[model samples]
Target: MAGVYDFTAQSLAGEDVPLTRFEGQVLLIVNTASACGFTPQYKGLEQLHRDFAARGFAVLGFPCNQFGGQEPGDARQIAEFCETKYDVTFPMFAKVDVNGSQMHPLFNYLKNEKSGLLGSSIKWNFTKFLVDRSGRVVGRYAPTATPDGMRKDIEALL
Candidate 1:
């Protein structure tokens, strides 16, 4: 019965953030990278946050360098890049492995609760996991899926 609420992750600022703080809110959790082809999706994610934040919706970004070393930067650098490049206002977490033995606990739960196209391991960066207000993992979106394309599901959860 463990859920997203049962996990905690370090923020881009290096502060510990308990996922329960976001309980009762629809969450779009994404693994991001600064130098990937999908890096531009940050703008769309920020837009989603702006459009639905007041309605109990949040977009949580976790920087991951496991893919092509696209996000190889310290927490400060990652935070700066997100703000300066995308004007991202949503929360961003410290870089973590998304697929492997060292994967973050939150991501392990996400993949177990909602596997993607072929399996539990995330295929690449930008993979998204949507959690309902109840802290249940509700959907898994591929890296190619755009943030804008998830509005309908987000609206339903909200």
Candidate 2:
């Protein structure tokens, strides 16, 4: 894909949503895991979404199980966990493989656009890719990166 808008991912509800729907919004796309230690970051992410959504910003969560099977839940379980535990109201997509040959096309484009400290491949669950309103990958945050710590960067784009 040429950019974020050129791809589409299945949502938690199983609908294919074209990235073009978020064309003019700054996006923070994360490969999430419900059972991971960083799972609690969902709260911070939801807070960020509520805080900046009016300014055209969004946090897109995509569950993954690549790391030690941290996210073992199916779509229903994942959605329930997020909504009940973290009160996550941000957009969430279906689970996907972020590494290896099975990696989703959207993630492939994201990794190629902005590589993390180690390399182009995503390091683990919760790894975040920040995209600008124009669909350019502006930042790649590691799994350890907290949502609050990224506020400054998000503000810069806004």
TM-score of each: 0.98, 0.98
In model 1, state the lDDT of residue 78.
91
lDDT of each: 0.93, 0.93
Q: What is the lDDT of candidate 2?
A: 0.93
| lDDT value, candidate 1, whole model | 0.93
Cα distance off (Å), candidate 1, residue 128: 0.5
Q: Write the per-residue lDDT of candidate 2 for residues 1-158, one digit (tens) a residue.
A: 39899999999999999989999999999999998989989999999999999999999999999999999999999999999999999999999999899999999989888888888988889999999999999999998999999999999999
User: Could you tell me the C-alpha RMSD of candidate 2 in Å?
Assistant: 0.8
**Tens-digit lDDT track of model 1 for 2-87:** 88999999998889999888989999999999999999999999999999999999999999999999998899899889999999
